[model samples]
Target: MMREVLTFRGKATAGTEFALGVAAAVVVLLLWEVVARLEFVAPQFLPPPSKVIAALWTMATTQHLLWHSLISSLRVWVAFLIAAAMAIPIGILMSSYRIVGAPLEPMIDFIRYLPVPALVPLSIIWFGVGEETKIFLLWLGTFFQLVLLVADDMRRVPHEYVEIAFTLGARPRQVMTDVALRSMGPNLVDNLRITLGWCWTYLVIAEIVAADSGLGFVIWSARRYVKTPEVMAGVVVIGLIGLITDQLLRALHRRMFRYL
Candidate 1:
């Protein structure tokens, strides 16, 4: 069983996969701890996981960690939902009709390539240092890329499906909504899952400029004070949150697309 698990491209049970993942994480953490204790890296710069965990506890108790986490999570979700809502329809239209896509695609392509951080100043000037600014930055980071992805997913829907729907007397709109969009459902969800991760990656950039009361702000504050443990703890929290959200989305995809 162990040999099979180690073999390239070999199948493994769910439990075996889970155990392997956990074992790998444990090994990495142990090595990190050893490196920290042996002073290979200064403890101030690379605190052991134990100290990081302790710092997490301290922040949770004294620094309104839950509140900050909630704030950050709320910002991410709100921006992501808005991006998804807008991107889906636009993406569908663009892919379903060349007239809609022709002029729009080039502009979207250009805007999406522009760095989000480079636009931070404009975002701050436009929205000010407030919730709107953070949300805008987060939304900006996600929307353009997601729009393209959504369009690509729609494109991947077989033209035969559209032809069959048309043969059945389905209207043009019906062919789009019922055939193309429905066919793209699983892939759309997967695209969203990937985009949500990108949103999280932009969180700190959104909050770092001029903000308060989010996980990013917490990390930035700790850094200014040279509290390495706190900084690491905050990063770990963001990573853990991202991991959990990703797993939830994966489970949802599996359940919803069981046929696939």
Candidate 2:
């Protein structure tokens, strides 16, 4: 009887948590609809959810939303891969060797503090307002931070584990790969997922730099014309895409790291 009661309570708690999120979203939307319907705020400034949905439908049907969204997503992935590829090896080296870590740590610390939006002017000057500029901006935003995260993950491996590998006739390289990298695999993946979310946070900054298409461009362009519904629609699309990709990454992380 006690076990049955506990089981029922557990399921009830789970159901309540899920329902809370849905209920909160519905309440917010209802409030928004009420404000817009009653003209509590200017219609041009805060369109109703219905208007945003209509704008989304129009963009999806007439404006090739899929194509631009694909481009933005591709740019994000490319930039994230570039950052991860460069950061992982350098981070591993930093964690493994004091000589490598000491000289570069200060520079990386300083660089990570610089705002990514502040780099747009330099990015434009260097990459000339093209796709490369956008990708580079995203890379710059993620790389330094990700390097620190990777190094931290590497450092979390037990020093005793590496010592055991060394005692068993493992070479330095073997200890790095077999002990350090192996132990850090799940953490490295989790860090990558975290940094990927960071990349999405910079999508608007990346896409607004003289961009002609993509969701960010849509938002920027609509703002100039005072198209509130379209602007909100574009913002919604970016959020949805980010949410979907983030969920996918979470699922992949769970599948890859069952221990987590």
Candidate 3:
């Protein structure tokens, strides 16, 4: 196993990979517990795993942790779905016609580079710090990036495939749908998976201001009172959720694109 892991470009079995990942996590947590016990860093600042777990239990039982998790998950999924719905078509349009892409690409490039957190004030003003504002922030963080990725995926579809379609008497629309979209299937899924992760990263920023619920709110509230254990627990919950979400997406990707 050591030799396999040491070998560059060597493929590990799925079970081996899963074992390695679990082992690494356990090792890190053990080290953290040891360090905290030794007071290398103040426990208040860096709570041990046991404290974090205890805090997590308290939150789940009394602080409505599950409710917060559900709300946060809903916000992320809703925004992500909306972003995907809009971005896929826009990206396809941009890639399908140079006339459509020429003007839009530069604007998307500019907007995507603009800091998401900096847009919080504008989002709040436009959407009134309601659920809309939170959703909009998550969407803003995802859409511009995903659209560009989708467009690039479309562009990467081989010209030979398009040429073949055309030679076979396929219409423009048919060529796009049959050739380009079909060819970029794996890449499109990969891009969506990546952009979904980005959406999660913006969750705290989305829920930072005017938020009374969700894991982000819990974390922020705990921080204000210096409740490090609760704060860490909230953060850990987010990390766990993200890890699960990512793994699910990876499973979907593998199941959908087995040939790749």
Candidate 4:
């Protein structure tokens, strides 16, 4: 007889999963609150959840926090899309042809290792420290790594699959378009999702140089005034925004790869 997947994990509903995730977050917050209340850590250094919420509420009502958050989110998405557009085609080209991959891989890797922050001056000179510089910073952080990720995913497709396609009289173009790209679609989506997180990581760095708006700007400004609660609030906003986008991507990935 075949065994049934009847364990707790196997039997979990979406509601149960959501509840568990919420519970885990609640537990962490409770612990942090306890520490803050007991004065285990200084309030100035580690504000409690209530204080952070109050700070965030003040910003929302008085300082246009939503607009700044939206600007930051737009920057992230624009940069991520640009990076994906540049990286995916090149990744496919490199993975498809050893002649192409061998020569260019070294140059790309070399540039990737040069820290993004080091490029801030160059980007400011080139793009004039406006939106372009910020977006470029976000792109630089994500593109090189994403190209490698997509290429690696493509290369991971089994040679046997390609051979099987060829045996069935599939043309090179058809094999690449129908088989290779399709096989890698789910993985590519996952790659985009992962790299989106990387794009968010660059936000503070991007906005710090000449920014007047963005969550990063808010956090940086709060820090200047020693507004620990406001800084924490801004950090929490970034985390929540990231969490939402991450989950959205994961949901889209699951929808795209349901057969898997």
Candidate 5:
């Protein structure tokens, strides 16, 4: 039957994808193990994959490194959410109103070019040496980027949609709600994905300043004592968490914008 044939083909495709993923993982691990054992690079600087895994396990079990890393990741995500929430609305408003955007354009441009890490001193002064400062720094780094992206997305929405809405006797508010916002969905999701990656990079910088706990703090502490394994372990944790977050965002985008 055609149904049976289609089911078999679907299973075959899934199996092939799974096999490719497993094979890629195995190849990477094998290469890492060989290079580390052969001392192709200083093991201290480039720890073996096995050593990294062992170090990760030890830290996870004994020192709660995983917990610390999770806390840092949560802080980054929270800051990112706050930034997106504030930026998207302001961006929409600016895009929708030329007068507002024209006046603010130069200031926004200036701030966008300012390196966020350089603002750590001011952040520390404003927020003090607390979690607040770290979160604030992360927010600062992500907010401007998302604002510009969202504003651009709004500007690029098809003019025809707005005209059609207007022709239907829709008010400006209705046009924005039904046409402009709907059109901006895919681009907004794309910007969020890009912003999430930016947030990860900024989180490390944020954690470096005035942080008592976090993966970044762990890495910083390890470097002082020359605990390379611990430092590498922290790096691995950040990468893994970032990858997981990105994949989740991608899945959410697919589900929310299925029509796109």
Candidate 6:
């Protein structure tokens, strides 16, 4: 009977927490609706939540804007995945070999600071204002940061782990694969979560440089036509998508690292 009471109390606490979160969201939405309807702020500049939702519904029915936004997001995801594939291995290799890392360090630092959007003209020149150029820009934006992150994580692994592996008659490859890599896994996953946020900003910047279609393009094109509601809708979509992706990554991390 005591145990049952404790369980009931625990559930009640969780329910209270959930209720508070829902109430907070509702209050914010109500405030926004009230302010917009009262014209306390310009509706054109700050459309109410209802207007944004209406715009989304109308756009969904009339145009493939959402489809285009998804395509743009997919491009960013694919490019980021490719960048990670290339960066992680190279980072591991660099961390394992001091000499290799030394020579590349300066060059990597230089390029990492360079603004990716500044390469738009050159990218178009090379890849010709197509999807390839956009993807390449996204890759360039994400690759250096990931490389640095992975390499840094690899370096932070305790030397004792490597020593233990060696004492157990493990080869260098075995030490890296079994000990160093596993140690770095959590940090790498965390960096990926952080990078997912960066990818949203990079995708918009990339699309702005050269794109006939995309969420960024939608926002940009809508601004030109003075479609403030559409622009607000696009902004909302971007935020929702970014939040969804972040949640998914968080879930993946929790699932994979449950033991940790």
The number of the candidate with the highest TM-score is 1
lDDT of 1 by residue, 142-207 (tens): 999999999999999999999999999999999988888889999999999999999998999988
Global lDDT of model 1 = 0.94
How well is each residue in 1-260 modelled by candidate 6, as lDDT tens digits? 33543684544456666776798999999998998889988878878889888988888778787787788889988999999998999888888898879987788889999998888889889999789998998899889988988889999999999999999999999898899988888889989888767878888887877888889888888889878889999888898888888899889988888888
What is the lDDT, from 0 to 100, of the residue 35 in candidate 6? 89
Candidate 2 wrongly placed segments (more than 4 Å): 1-13
Q: Which regions of candidate 5 deviate over 4 angstroms?
A: 1-18
lDDT of 1 at 193: 98
Task: Enumerate residue pairs that collide in model 5.
Answer: none
Task: Output the number of the lDDT-best candidate.
Answer: 1
For each candidate, give its TM-score against the true structure: 0.97, 0.92, 0.95, 0.90, 0.90, 0.91
Question: Candidate 1, 236: how far from true, in Å?
Answer: 0.6
lDDT score at residue 14, model 3, on the 0-100 scale: 90
lDDT of 5 by residue, 1-260 (tens): 33543684544456666777898999998998898899989877777888878888898999889779888988888999999999999898888899878887778889989998889999888989888998888898899888988999999999999999999999999999999999999889989898988988988888877787899888898889877888888898998988887899899999999996
Q: Which regions in candidate 1 have their CA more than 4 angstroms from the true location?
A: none
Per-candidate local distance difference test:
0.94, 0.89, 0.93, 0.90, 0.87, 0.86
Model 2 C-alpha RMSD to native = 3.1
Q: Worst ten-residue run, lDDT, model 6?
A: 1-10
Root-mean-square deviation of every model: 1.1, 3.1, 1.6, 3.6, 4.6, 4.2
Would you list the clashing residue pairs of candidate 2? none
User: What TM value does model 2 have?
Assistant: 0.92
lDDT of 6 at 61: 79
**Weakest lDDT window of 10 consecutive positions for candidate 3:** 201-210
Flag the better candidate by lDDT, 2 or 5: 2
Q: What lDDT is reached at residue 232 by model 4?
A: 93
